[model samples]
Target chain A: MRLALLAAAFCALAVPALAQTSRPEPGPLTIAKQGSFFIGGREVKSDTLSTLPNFDAAGTITVDQMYVRYQAPAGQTGVPITLIHGCCLTGKTWETTPDGRMGWDEYFLRQGHPVYVIDQVWRGRSATDPSTINAVRTGKKPVDQLPTVFSAGHEGAWAIFRFGHQYPQVLPGMRFPLAAQAEFWKQMVADSAANLPTPNPTVPALSELAQKIGGTVLMSHSQSGIYPFQTAALSTQGVAGIISIEPAACPDPTADLGPYKAVPILVLFGDYVDEFPRWAPRLKSCRAFAAAVSAAGGKAEVLALPEIGIKGNSHMLMQDDNSLYIADILLRWIGKNVTATR
Target chain B: MRLALLAAAFCALAVPALAQTSRPEPGPLTIAKQGSFFIGGREVKSDTLSTLPNFDAAGTITVDQMYVRYQAPAGQTGVPITLIHGCCLTGKTWETTPDGRMGWDEYFLRQGHPVYVIDQVWRGRSATDPSTINAVRTGKKPVDQLPTVFSAGHEGAWAIFRFGHQYPQVLPGMRFPLAAQAEFWKQMVADSAANLPTPNPTVPALSELAQKIGGTVLMSHSQSGIYPFQTAALSTQGVAGIISIEPAACPDPTADLGPYKAVPILVLFGDYVDEFPRWAPRLKSCRAFAAAVSAAGGKAEVLALPEIGIKGNSHMLMQDDNSLYIADILLRWIGKNVTATR
Candidate 1:
């Protein structure tokens, strides 16, 4: 009877073996320093600055407010990395991944690199003002088009990304780590459609962030890929290196990238380009931009996974099943070109 | 010394242990039918059949050949299943995943279903004459188009699948067995581009294969989705049921689906649909087709994983990490609708 009771207890305990999603016992991680910075502020006499309804007041107005979250291991890799997420997403992109796995934020920290993740002005914790952001030269009675934000559902993504041969037709070799897709979809935020054109505020704010944390490596994803490129050009000495993962857009074709000559850059592209027709032109532009950078004596290396014999990777390489494998590659490259060399 | 040699031998045997990629020890599996069949033959006159240096000699010519590999467990389910792969792929799609994991072929076999995997006529072992296939009148010069076939490279897929947010970006929850990518890529074949507009010979050949193996459930993927639909229309009594995974196109919208009224059908869609723009219309069409089937009194169930609370599945649910999970659902549905009800 005792033995039966013991077996029953064991069975009860083992039946629902839920995967533990919590972090391990606290590691030697310390919050070095974290704060907020304001950029693009101009002193102006505003007619409606007061909290009171449309009351006139004079004060300084800031265009954007930037929030920074920095963490470092006890033993740091002298070279720090500042992670910048794409539009809509916040610093959370670098934190835990959708499927509850350690994200690049934690991965980099464990690798002994001081990590700094930031929410660009008017995003996430930085907050936003819809009226100010959507203000346009409309008419006598101004109308605020709160920036028609759009968010993709599952079907839209499956087709555009070529997750499978096409929607519903998953290929045999796709490696997107799809098990955590629900958690991933949660990360999708409504991005401003208006911001597709320019980078006036975001580029300057991020450049300032880089300058503030001098000698930092800039890692950017998707739409924010241009941040590091523009940042490197604006704050030349502040950035040690740049790693761009499928930048939504490319560096200017006409502009001289000479300032980035001394800075090393790695542009990584994953699988399923031919299936999505839109990617062809974007990739071509990126390739051309990289080629121009090389011509300007800049050490820019474009790593298209297929060309390198690596197959079945999607756009989200960081959260992939072989994420650690790719992360190791990035770390090795960083150690060789930035950390060790420095 | 003798003891040391014994220990050394044991260590050598165990030190570099590798996962067994080979088939498991022989189970109670029996080969029901394994052979080739030729269809569509035309006999030429003796004068035309004689071959000379300058003149063409023609004998009896067969346009299509079909190969079938069938296996059943000792105690087989009365219902058998015929597995067909998508474009540029073969029956291997159901055999093993790109990451060296067991595919539905093995999964269903273990579950006691007699499995029939086929190389659609002209693909894989069912070889066809390219010259004969390309002879169709497409343009002015009778130039052999030979189909402008394309196989998506690694990077192309990474972005399109919403695997990571873009190419090379793997998410945290991706269940794709990525380690076996090399083996997976080997299975990719160049499909016939000319067949896009019409099912023609391929569908007929598949239908014949289904007919040859009576009372078989037809499971089709990608380009092959159309085959089972058309096959059911042609070989109505032969196919007991149909399972379509992201069919490239659906049955003719204009045609009456009354033939499939008695047939049970299940259509499954995976994750990241929002990322792919083309999927919207395609999926809309598929949904419409499935709706039509149901309205016509057919038992058609359309499963969008996310809508059903099963998330992060790419197009390739069979080869996914959670493949078994989806398989279980399919089996349950199969049992409840086909096996049990019957």
Candidate 2:
């Protein structure tokens, strides 16, 4: 009788455990003080691919573009991922070795979604903006790290940026001048809109390609995460959903994320952030975004991670348990939420 | 002879211990994923600084920022962190049970660097654009109980964003009209440039605030660790260094991160990260960002996290010794790096 009672008690305890969310309850969401690190760069030893591009020509366009290849699942028509590279790296940063897995794309392919990786124009293996690069010759700044219209605490740097924005046409810092920059940007935007690479038919970034391929899911990490908002706002087609790694917060809450109204966004921040904004607070931005989306009657899921140390945790979740969690969320959503049945 | 041998062994151990980072080494940076939450209706709960600026009026501006504040050594400067939130969460998400103090931020503050919290736009109490909000009222999909952009996904909703460009006149909502959105956005873009808020010398995100308030050093648990990248990237004056708790990764390496770069990024991914990016993927983004930045000539440090279910393995690290370990890292970073004394 005593042994039976003990067994019964254990069984009861186990039953309760089965109904739990598996992890401890998380705290509320707040602003975060974090720096932004996006994209990956290839391990290029020599300066061969490092040669800078110029934007100094009167009408020539100096555009920087990144390209990547992501393999898709053979048969499943699922969500597609279009990755954009951030500042200093190429798409290679998202790749890692864990449990002997080959790459993120391969892992995702096995689980379902097709991967479409894109190298943002400028930093990694992509084309560089020559005019900005050659700005060093103008002696304005030692290097051309600052982008046009960027504001910083540095007075001289700010002034230079302001001046450049106003008269970029006349600035002499490129193989192709302001005209080239503008034209290149226009073309890039058009290209992104018109033809998203079809790594697989499900690659949503390529609407036509994805439609032909079927059931595309959209995913981004770091700097590339920003593209989803841009693409969703600009594109004519509908995407399956959005998955973002660590994306940079736009200084203007109302400004940056204004386009994605009903888009399901999944944001996962690091437990211990390294940097905070010089102008505002992190929680402020986070809350503002969440509130804004909810106020618009949209769904926004936030996961404040404690700590799982995947190197690509900030960019790609393929190796991190967080990614699996997100993937599960997607699976659940697709199974029960979206109108498009898998 | 036995006593001498024992003493010799002790000395050998002591020598290596004394030769450590010269300060404290925060707990390892790892990828961890736990719990799920949403950033909904939190906007109605914010402390408003100004009146609701018209989302449609010309010359309107809406800004959302993320930063942090933590308890650090009285004189510490650049601390470390782990951003712990989803795309829709803010530093506040780190707030739970034992109150904000028991929260990750407080835990780190007790250790050294005041936790830098972030509230990303589209989540938490941050602002949102009205035009993007209009997507919820679409004729194609079902509304009500609608997930915010952060929680949901779709290309049509996200298509409105332009990189580095913003519409300050936009408000948050799904009720705004389409034609009105275009006019509103156009007017907003044109008018926004006129009355841009003048930069303030008194405030600089959180670090400067902490510096003025007198503080130094930092540490974090999860997503909060990733915030440093943003803080560092946007800061007029960069941080000395950072010590991460369980650091997150950037986003997809295939995306663009060249715009934001961190010189020295440290990571500590726990074994738990294996299922992270799969679950949250955003964690992977944080890791990828670190890789990209490290590739850009910065220091990228990653470590393994302690196992869970261990006696002292609280995620917040307040009850655990992890916060103290984080404090150690901040001490070392401040003692060695950060040439300019705050």
Residue-wise C-alpha lDDT for candidate 2, range B1-342, written one tens digit per residue: 523533442332223322321433233221111111112111121111111221111122223222222223333333444333432123433432211113354444444443444343322222232221122222222332122221111111122221001223322321123332221111100001111122211113334433443333233334345444444444524354555555434434555554344334444443333433231354455556566666775555443332211122222333222333433444454445444334
Tell me how candidate 1 scores on lDDT. Answer: 0.58
Stretches of model 2 off by over 4 angstroms after superposition: A1-62, A98-102, A131-215, A250-259, A273-284, A306-342, B1-342
The TM-score of chain B in candidate 2 is 0.43
Off by over 4 Å in 1: A1-62, A132-146, A165-169, A193-197, A339-342, B1-342
Clashes of 1: 63
Residue B229 in candidate 2, Cα distance off native in Å = 43
What TM value does model 1 have?
0.43
TM-score of chain A of each: 0.78, 0.51
Q: Chain A of model 1, TM-score against the native?
A: 0.78
The DockQ values of the predictions, listed in order, are 0.01, 0.01
lDDT of 1 at A77: 59
